[model samples]
Each structure stands twice: as C-alpha cells, then as structure tokens.
Target: MFGFSIQKLLFTVAVIAAVWYGFKWVGRMKKVREREARERLRRQAGNGGGGGTGESGESGAGGSVSGVAEEMVECPACGAFVAATGAKSCGKEECPFLG
Candidate 1:
C-alpha cells in the first residue's frame, strides 16, 4: 500500500520545483523582452519619428567580395530561391521555400 506521508512529500517537492522553475523562466523571458524593447526604442529615437530605421546598414558596403550570396538562381518549375551551382531543378513539385 502506498503511504500518504510519502505521497505528500513527493507532491510538495514537485510543487516547489514547479514554482521555482516557473519564476526563473518568467524572469529570463522578461529580461529578454525588456532588452529588445530598449534597443527598439533607442533605434526609433535616434532615427526620429516612430518609424524604424530606413534600410539596415550592411557591414561590407560596396566592398567587392566573391561571396556565395551573389550567386542566385530561380527554379524554372517553381519560383524559389536557390543557389546557382548545385540546385536541382524542381520539375514536378513546387519548392518548399516558395510555398
């Protein structure tokens, strides 16, 4: 027979653990949200008006680099973005990225 005392002890431990984890999780999430909000507010204030910064600044602007991003290909069967070199032609089915 399962004793009530043992069951009660386990239940108490479970409840305490649940409450502790919930609090920690919520606190972490709150910090993340606050940080994001502050960054957004700062960016908005700096740019003036409520609108976000117009066009993000690229790190290597106008710097000529032979990168893979420059090479792009459009599937003939489906208008999905794919790499130019080794992309298989979608003959029958539409590409997942497009859908």
Candidate 2:
C-alpha cells in the first residue's frame, strides 16, 4: 500500500520550490553577464573611436581595438590571408602591400 504523508508532501513542495528558484537565479545571472558584456563592448567602442595618444599600445593607423572584426584579404603570392586595412608584406617578392 502507498502512504501519502504530510511530511512527504511538504518535502516535495520544498524541492520543487528550490529547483524553480535555482533556475530563476541562474537566468538572472546569465542576463547580468550579458548586460555587462554589452556595456564593456560599448565603452570600448566609444573610447576606441576617439583618436587618442595610443596608450593601449595597439599599432595601427586607426588604433584598432581588440574584439573588433576586420576585413581580410588573401595574399596573391603567398596565398595567406591578411587584414585588408593594414596588410603586411608576406616577405615574398611578388607579395603586394609593403611590410
């Protein structure tokens, strides 16, 4: 025979509540992380767009910042891919764009 006791019912309810709240907490944390990432990206873009004294030590005409995607071009002679904005020489005689 199956017995349905008040303690069993209460324990089941507590477990359900704990799981529900745990999922909610996890969701909240994920949202917070995503918001922080977006804010960080926004700040980087704002600071990177303004031409400064190059304190970050990033070498480029535009002072390119990390995490930003750049257009790539394939080298005709070496068959290597390089950034289109500041393509460097592949050290080959036929390579275009001076090193």
Pairs that clash in candidate 2: none
lDDT of each: 0.70, 0.81
**Can you list the residue pairs that collide in candidate 1?**
none
The positional error of residue 90 in candidate 1, measured at the CA in angstroms, is: 73
Candidate 1 lDDT over 42-86, as tens digits, reads: 666556433453644345589665422447777666776677666
* Candidate 2 off by > 4 Å: 1-4, 51-72, 78-80, 90-94
TM for candidate 2 is 0.50
Q: What lDDT does model 1 reach?
A: 0.70
lDDT value for model 2:
0.81
Instruction: Report the poorest 10 consecutive residues by lDDT, candidate 2.
Output: 52-61
